[model samples]
Target: MTKKKKIKISELPNFDIVDYLKTDKDIAQYLTVVLEDGDPALFVAAIGDIARAKGMSEISKKSGVTRESLYRALKVEARPRFETVTKVIHALGMKLSVHA
Candidate 1:
């Protein structure tokens, strides 16, 4: 007979995806995967993660959107407008494209 030991959830190290998004390729790949999931909220959250990783202050300046607005727009389950998304993408040095 063997006894199993239980591990406490609090013992696990904290993990933040933003910390791993250190390069353009990494951010692109992450966003692509989120898009493939076909969930708008998830995609929005992914963008928010990348924005945080890249610095919300800089993104807001480049995107011409206020930092406060960006925060609200990118928050979880937020339904930001297309223009806002495009602006943020441009600020992040990325673009959107379509293909059949």
Candidate 2:
């Protein structure tokens, strides 16, 4: 019989937000997929995921914006102000575009 080793919870390393985001491209990909799907709930969920992936707490701190405000701006059917959108995109290392 083989014996298995047990690991302590405290022994686990702290989570690295940037490292996780880099490794998991799903956050961005999922958002794109949701946008394609055109489902409001899924879109909102994707926005939340992106916000978390981009370190919403940190971004909110740096941008001097409340987390709730950020969430509202990212919600489906939200017509966020140009400045707010710019702040979010800049924080997430993304660019915004428009199409005809």
Candidate 3:
């Protein structure tokens, strides 16, 4: 009989979407996937992911949203105001576009 190998949690490779979203092309691809998911949480989560990718503190500063508020607003359970969302999006150098 052959022996099976076991892998520990610590032995697993770290995977972070933010790390993959370093370029405009990468961010666009990620956003395309998020939009395809058609889940609001995913959109909010995408923003959160981008925020983290660009440094939450810097995003907060650029958005005029406190770090605490940014964290709370992007939470899956939180329904933050549209204006606040816009600010964060703009801070991340992104904007919403409409399609027919």
Candidate 4:
């Protein structure tokens, strides 16, 4: 029998926080949690977590947006315009809000 490979947390790549953020499922879940908790900071924190996971520098380059702009848009007090939100979400491969 082959020896089982032991994986270490440190050895493993960081979780794909950006991929999670980019998915509709994740956004839905986050929205649900936010609605329940009523904390915009948590939402901003989540976005920041994803940005860090995906390498903010790379994301900024690919998204045609500055890292500082992204951070500002995701900040707790930020009132990002719909267009700005759309651009960020699209850049991140996420979908927008829809009414059913």
Worst 10 residues of 3 by lDDT: 73-82
Q: State the lDDT of candidate 1 residue by residue for 30-93, as single tens digits.
A: 9999999999988888988999999999999999999999989997779999899999999999
Q: Model 3, range 14-88, lDDT digits (tens) per residue?
A: 988888888888888898899899988878878888899889999999999999999999977778898999999
Q: In lDDT terms, which candidate is top?
A: 1
Model 4 Cα shift for residue 56 (angstroms): 1.5
Pairs with steric clashes in candidate 4: none
Candidate 2 segments whose C-alpha is farther than 4 A from its true place: 1-24, 39-45, 77-79, 97-100
Q: Estimate each model's TM-score.
A: 0.91, 0.52, 0.86, 0.52
Per-residue lDDT of model 4, residues 1-100, tens digit only: 8999999989988764455665567766765676468675666555555555557777677677789988887766776665665566566666646477
Would you list the C-alpha lDDT of every candidate in the order shown? 0.93, 0.66, 0.90, 0.66
Off by over 4 Å in 3: 6-10
In candidate 1, list every pair of residues with a backbone clash: none
Cα lDDT tens digits, model 2, 1-100, are 8998899999999874334455336556655677789776655555556777767898787666789998887766676676776676566666656689
Ranking by TM-score: 1, 3, 4, 2
Cα error of candidate 4 at position 94, Å: 1.1
